[model samples]
Every structure is written in structure tokens, then in C-alpha cells.
Target: MPDGTVPQSVLEIRRDLAAAYRLIALEGMDDGIYTHISARLPDGPNGEKRFLLNPFGLRFDEVTAANLVTVDETGAVIDDPYGAGVNAAGFTIHSAVHMARHDAVCVLHTHTVAGVAVSSVKEGILPLNQWSAQFFDRIAFHDYEGIALNLEERERIVADLGNRFVMMLRNHGTLVLGRSVAEAFKLAINLERSCKAQVAALGMGLTPVVLSDDVAEHTARQYQSAYDAMELGNQSDPEWAALLRRLDAVAPDYLG
Candidate 1:
């Protein structure tokens, strides 16, 4: 039901999405063999939906552009993993999100230390400071229902995600979806930092000062533009470039 020439710009997206996986590993957001990141492939000439995602059993740090697996929305392999099939559980969950949210071009899911810790908290993420304040009124929580293996679970996940960029998978981990790999990576970084800050603040045994409603709104607005502002600096020091460098150092093969 979609028609348009597949843009050449998509090649850049593939490179960036691959870079994002490496960066996620460099940032300590990867969960060993778990968690997956995906980007929707532009529709083909025949109106088919295909997507690129990391292969099964591959560590995030080991992922590469050439090695990224391509698959249809129904969990069928379109391009061989440069080796084997992708994780069905991971692809199923990611594919559901892509099928339901057309605006979501890049999907990132993680089970990092701080994110999982916060997910277990009864109050979830709090607006205790600037970092957390940015997400004060923007987060959505999905009560955990095992390891996300069920295709049936996608309905509730989509319902809970709605239009928010961040979702706390209660008792499991955190999932961040975005229209671009950079946007999704940025959201994941902020959400994880916010959660880490919360855990650290609470560990100090001191009551934290919470942000006011107006300030929270203002901060969130600033963050919405933070990506652009950060890129205004010299290209050599651009945050995305810096992120890629970090990935190169930790997982050099990811750009392949």
C-alpha cells in the first residue's frame, strides 16, 4: 500500500544503523547475546516490507554493516546473515514494532544495568534532576510478561508504547524507538543515563530534589534540539562521529 522510489539516502541509514550497534556496545548497553537493534528497509518495487537487523548469537560489538541480516516483516530471512539465521525471538519482537509504527525506522532495545534496575523500581524513573526531568512526562511502561517471545505480546507492547520514544519493559529491560538511528541511540543514551543517575542518587541515602513542572517541560524541549546543537560543532568532534570512533575502538568490525 506504499509507493515511492526508494531513496539513495537509505544507504547512509544502513551505515549509521550499523554504527549504532557498535556504539551501543561501546556504551556498555549490550546484554551479551541478548537485546537487538533494527532498521526498516525501504519498501521494495513490489510493495514488500524488509528490514535489517543484527544476526542471531552475534554480540553487539561483533556486528558489522555487511554482516547485518535482512528479513521480511513476517520473520522470514531475506538476506542470509552472512552466515546463519537471526534470532527468531528478537526478530519477532522487532518486526512487530516496525509493522505497527511506520514512523519508527530504527528500533533499539537493551537490558543494561541501570535500565533494568530502574525497570524493577516501583516508582519507575523519577524527575529528580535535569537528566531525569527531560523524560518526566514522556515515558511509558509495559508490565513484563516473560521474555517477549510471543507474537501475541506485540499488541500490548504497541498499545503501551503509543507515541512515546521510551518504554520501560517492566521486569525485563528498556526499549527505545526512533525515526533515525542517531535519534534512537540518543534516546537510549539519555534514558540509560537518567536511570543510572537515579540509582546512584538513591544509593547516596539522601532525599533528592525533584524538578518543577515548568522546568521539566523546558528541559525536555531543550533535549529535543540537543542533537542538532551538538552537531553544530566541528565535524571532527561531532557526537555521532565520536560515538562511531568509540565503537571502532571497541568493535572495529561493525562498519563492515
Candidate 2:
């Protein structure tokens, strides 16, 4: 808050984000300790933006609310009690979105097999089914720029992302954004499911019938309407609540 102290609100964010890490690991969407997920903290006392990110060597399942490092806008860790500082490249990717998209409070990036499979293809997120339809034309693609260690790449990442909620990092992985950790977790899971389904369908060797443009657009609109309601506070996400219940039952240590 005023000094180096993290307010209770930020602690709640850390709890939710740690839960997300555990859930991702549970869902088989994590890649060791490589990929990263980040949540933007409320403006600090000096009004400078801060972020919460996983430390460099912790597996997704190893993350805990108490261990997430807090970093400033320059991607420098400001508070790392465990001395496990944030990953520089991870910060490079996440900071781009956090700084560019103010409303996207939670940004999740993954390097799952299915996600990378979809990202490698020229056409990203085809509408082969209902789950896929949700992101039919709603996904953005950013060409892989080496290891994202360079700060200059942040601008290009922002430009490529535009206003899309989902981004497939070409030949790399998937990135999803949400207004909250719950929403971000939901979107990431759905995107991963869609990618897995797409890979399975493509392996069948049959020319899978793709959804028609009209149908895909209509289905996307349906998904968008639900997102609108959720974003506008008209309704709460039952799935997010249920997932959190499941996480608490299975991995309550995330709250630490």
C-alpha cells in the first residue's frame, strides 16, 4: 500500500492467482516452470502500476499466494520474500499486455502441447465445434519473435494483440486475458480445451467439416453476450465458482 506492504485486496488477488496456477497444473496445461501467468496489482501508493508473477523456478503447482513476487512497471521485482525473483522473459511477455490493456487485469500464458499445436498452424482457432466457435474469429496471432527477452518486442506484441481476449503466440503457445483471475482462468481452460479438440479432430485424417461462417459468427455472438453480462456485473460465472470449489477441495495449499 503506502510502503512495501501489500493491501488485503492484493492478497485476495494473490490467493485467486495461486489457485489459477494450481488449476492449470491440475488441468495439464502447465509446462514445468516455463510459461507464466500474471495479475496486475492496483496502483501502488505512488500511483505506479505493479504486477504479481510467479517466481522463476517454481512449478505451476508449487506456486502459493505468499510466494508470488510483486514487480513494478519496469519488470523489476519489488517484493520477493522468498528471494525467488520473477522470470525476465516471462515479465517481458506479461508486462506488454498488462501495460497495454488496462482492463485486462489477469493475463495467462501457457505452453501446453495442444496450445502449441494450434499456434503452429497458419489458421488459428478454427470453428470445428462449439468450444472452438467461442474463439472463432476472436483470437489474435503474434509471430514468434525469438525468446521475447528484448524489451522492444513488447510494442509489437501489443500491436498484434489489439483488443482480442485470446492470443496464440505463433509456434509458441496461447495467451488469454480476463478482467479477473476467475475470468482469466475460465477463458484459458476453454481455449486449451478447444485446442485439444482441434488437434484430435485434425488427427482423424478425414476432412473435418468446419462450421460455416454464419454459424461461427452467431455462436461467437452468443459467447460474447455472456461475457458482456459477466463483465457488466449482470451475472456471475457458475463454472468459475465450481472450479474454485474443486481447487479448494483438492489443493487448499494454494491459499498459503
Best-performing candidate as measured by TM-score: 2
Lowest-sum lDDT 10-residue window in model 1: 1-10
| TM-score per candidate, chains pooled | 0.89, 0.94
Model 1: residues with Cα > 4 Å off, grouped in runs: 1-8, 227-237, 248-251
72-174: candidate 1 lDDT, tens digit per residue: 9987888875777888778777888888888677889999989999999889998887788878778888999987887899999999988877889998899
lDDT per model, in order?
0.80, 0.86
Task: List the lowest-lDDT window of 10 residues for candidate 2.
Answer: 1-10
Give the per-residue lDDT of model 2 (tens digit) for 1-256: 0112222378778988998999999999998888888998889898988999998899999999999999987779889977978787778878888888877878999999999988999988889998899887788889997887888988998999998888999999999998778778888988998999989999999898899999999998998788766765668778777888998899988888
